[model samples]
Target: MKNSTPKANFESFSFSEDILSAIKAMGFKKPTDIQLKTIPAVLEGKDVLARADTGSGKTAAFVLPLLDNLSNQNVYLRRGRDERFDSSKRAVSN
Candidate 1:
């Protein structure tokens, strides 16, 4: 992971806006133990392997960070059908 730091206890870090929004929508007020440990590591793009008892909030740990990064990208959709078709053809040919 770039800019890796010492692993932090789950209670120490804060989540970004989109994550907090989704977490609230899912009715989670605080981070679970796995969430605490995994979120920071994933945010740093580090390779992680975690094992936990079933029904833990493992899905949110990864989903939140991925959504956050994708939302921040400077991507613009194609403006016309021709542009979209051209792009798709290029992708398929490549």
Candidate 2:
């Protein structure tokens, strides 16, 4: 049977600039098999379980979607408080 997974691209999904920038900075050319499988399901709020070799684009698969979700909700997370804040870093109340 033919495989049914639709091809995915970072630009095809509605990711924030920071996430896309990070992806570019990380030199991610495209999604790996694991990433291709996991990213869409995770974005859809579905649980996924996958395993791939080291150096696979696993981190991006999870982090990118989570960052995108947070960005959509107007919750920006940064490591250092000393850094200047942009509107992307606005805190949202529940």
Put down candidate 2 lDDT per residue, 1-94, tens digits, no spaces: 1234656777766678888888889888777887777877888888777788998878878888987887677444453665433446554343
Question: What is the C-alpha local distance difference test score of candidate 2?
Answer: 0.73
Assess every candidate by TM-score: 0.63, 0.70
Off by over 4 Å in 2: 1-4, 76-94
User: Among all windows of ten consecutive residues in candidate 2, which has the lowest summed lDDT?
Assistant: 85-94
For model 2 the local lDDT of residue 13 reads 63
Cα lDDT tens digits, model 1, 1-94, are 2333433432344555655666678787777677777778887777878877887988877787676666556444554554422321231221
| Candidate number achieving the greatest lDDT relative to the actual structure | 2
Q: Provide the lDDT at 33 for model 2.
A: 80
lDDT of each prediction vs. the true structure? 0.62, 0.73
